[model samples]
Structure formats: structure tokens, C-alpha cells
Target: MGYCRSKDLDFAFKVFEEMALKGFKRNEVAYTPLIHGLCVARRVDEAMELFAKMKNDDNCYPTVRTYTVLIN
Candidate 1:
């Protein structure tokens, strides 16, 4: 999230991928930051992809805030 706030999206993504590789099971706590980061970067398309992936890839349901972020 710090990386995201710094607008260091590439590094942010590296951290995100590293977490997955480390076998850490991520939930909204994880997805929200990444999604927010992407959105902050104006990569809304990627954020949307991530939001959808939360369901399709992780089988985790998105919360209201998730939809709100993507929508706005």
C-alpha cells in the first residue's frame, strides 16, 4: 500500500505477486489495496480485472467498497 501511495505500481505488483508465491492466502485485505493502487494509477481496467479475478481466480466475493471503487 505504501508503494501504491508512492505510485510505484510496478513494485507494488511485484509485492503482490511475491505474496501469492509465498503461499499467503489473500482476501479483501489484499485485493483492496492492489485494486485501489491500480485505480490510483488510472489503470481502472486492470483494477476491474483484479476485482473480477477476486471472484473467478480466488473465489472471493467483492464487497461494496470494491464495486464502489471500480464504479467511480
Candidate 2:
């Protein structure tokens, strides 16, 4: 999140990938910041892809705020 806030997406992604590799269950809690950051960075296409992945991903449900973030 700090990384995302800093707009350091490359680092954020590395960290997120590490978390996933370590078996950390990445749900919307994790998805939100990345998606929101991507949107804010004007990379909405990537954000939308990530949002869709959340749907296919097991146990990862997007919150209303997630939609709001993307929509805005």
C-alpha cells in the first residue's frame, strides 16, 4: 500500500508477487490498492484486468468500494 501510494507499481507488484509466492491469500484487501493505484495512474485497463482476476480468483471478492474506486 505504501508502495502503491508512492506510485511505485513495479515494487508493489514485486511485493505482491512475493506474498502470493509465499502462500499469502491475496483477496480484495490486497487488490484494492493496486487497482486503485493503477486507475489513479491512468492505467484503468490494467486495473480492470486485475478486477476481473479478482472474480476468477478463489475467495477473493471485490468490495463496493473497489467498484467505486474503479468507476471513478
Taken over the whole model, the C-alpha lDDT of each candidate is 0.82, 0.92
Q: Write the per-residue lDDT of candidate 1 for residues 8-37, one digit (tens) a residue.
A: 888988988898899987788778888998
Quote the RMSD, in angstroms, for model 2: 0.7
Candidate 1 residues lying further than 4 Å off, grouped into runs, are none
* Model 1 alpha-carbon miss at residue 21, Å: 0.7
Could you tell me the TM-score of candidate 2?
Answer: 0.95
**Model 1: how far residue 40 lies from native, Å:** 2.0
Q: lDDT winner among the candidates?
A: 2
Error of 1 at 37 (Å): 1.6
